[model samples]
Target: MPLLGLVSEYLGFFALLAAIVLVWKDSPWQKGTKVAATIGAMALLGAVLPAPPEDGAATVTAEADGKAAGGGSAAGVLAPASPTAGTTPEPSPRPRPEAADYRGMTLDDARDRAEAAGFGVDEHDASDEDKSIMMRLNWTVCFQKTGWTSSGTKTIDFGAVKNGAPCPAADGGAIPWPTMPDLVWKTWKTAHQEVAALGTVPGDHIMASTAYLNDQLPDEGEYDDWRVCVTDPAEGGDVTVDLRVTLELTHPDNGCPDPDREDGDRPDLPDRDDDGDPDYRDPFPGDRNRTSAFPNGLTGGSDDSSDGNGGGGGDHWNCPRTRWC
Candidate 1:
């Protein structure tokens, strides 16, 4: 290509020389010399200029199905037959009975109660420590809350999996990610708002259960009674959060969530069969035959759990039977 361009340029110089010879014929300007010089310049340009190499090699690349592993499977590949317009899609699956309390309270239950009281259950946990129950509840909560169930709970051993999508608000409120109601959110909020007001030490300084203790009711009266030692100091550059919650009733009720609590702070106990440690025991004992459900710390009245935020509070249950740090 370069040599071609150079030759084309030198042709112009030859033409110029030819024109001068024609304009001043036999004027001792050496017409033959001019023609020879033009030809030599053209030859030099053609000799020195570069030329493009002929097309030869081609590149090859591997093709994939465009689907990532452990990602969207077959169903994800299919497109809808028609565009959706002026219509609503079918709702997601509601949580199963396994997701509900004995009192028939699912996130839907909480939502109904919240709506009845001019509010809404902002989010819920589709999963908990109980995998069997969680599996069933996952579908149920996902269905009823559809977009909101994604606020579902995450277990302590969260690994490399990308978190599920967040729960959209039923009433368009803020959505909390990674997990939902049941306990952690309520515990943190109560620690920041309610409990800390009583001059108790902040939970940011304690070693506590990261999950909710449902059957184990909250301790009340003084902050000192509920004080648990911080067994695990945070690692280097890690945040130190000590969560201690004491649920005190503004008014006592005989029909409180649980039966054993006649009117006092319930204690937590240990479960030996599950290979769980004494300090880290499951609060709600399904095999233990306990049944009671209360939202927030309210008793005798059907009130939606408002753990500071609109989401249901973690049902509190503490047992001196099993000491939790």
Candidate 2:
């Protein structure tokens, strides 16, 4: 009935479309109106016609069962080839192909096979329209059933989208950040263990560094005698997932020399002007007239224009013209 209904709708719609198309070029009201009227009359006649009887279907079933009006074999019924008192019954046109054995196949392959075998395919998670339109095999079909059939109707069931959606966070698409555990006072070994337990690799996500890994990185093979002093966010702080965090460690009780400590040690360099200032330490190493430069007249060579005035921009009390105030 559904197929027949489709046929009726298609026929009527095609007739209207064909009429329009055929007369679209040289269309005058008379030709279009005539076509429409003819189609309308045909539709009316079809509606008034009597429906066909379903006797053919009944006759076929009766013949298959070997029954007739007078309690005898049907005229069209063929006797079993073996002339035995009781013979095995013949099979009907094999059941619309079975939908079983479709497991383990991708959703695309499964749908193709099922549909090709005379089953209508349907799916779930359609709200995720993006996932459904995916390469067809994007979501795996977990379960399926060959539904019941009666007369000429059938119901097929497919439990698809059991795998997951295509969007992020549905299948670990979004990065997950675990809270920075309290690894400050813990040993490097223990800290790494805790980081691993939080679903991050030690050497990859968490890095163990001896002071701080700045421009220069220390040897990758050295992590002994060092206690964790700092994590990027400290304890109880949240950090990005998979971001390599430097686990800065401090030497135990200052046992090893701390490279970051300021020991007042200075570098050696030549003083071209030799104004009691090393080239590296002197602000104006090349300028013989000035050993250092100062802004706002704080501490610089005396300015002669303001000298001996007892009130100058470079001197507070005009102490000397050759020196700072």
The list of candidate 1 runs beyond 4 A from truth reads 1-29, 52-108, 111-325
Candidate 2 residue-wise lDDT, 49-167, digit = tens? 44654897666766666575568776667544555678776766646445567655677888887777777777543223334345666556555656556656544555444333222
Clashing pairs in 2: none
Candidate 1 per-residue lDDT over residues 198-302, each given as its tens digit: 232354433233122322334432222232211122112212123334332211111123424575344333454332322233333332322223112221223
lDDT (CA) per prediction: 0.34, 0.54
**TM-score for each of the candidates:** 0.15, 0.26
* Cα lDDT, model 2, residue 219: 55
Task: Kindly give the stretch of ten consecutive residues in candidate 1 with the minimal lDDT sum.
Answer: 154-163
Q: Runs in model 2 with CA error above 4 Å?
A: 1-178, 210-218, 237-241, 254-325
Indicate the TM-score of model 1. Answer: 0.15
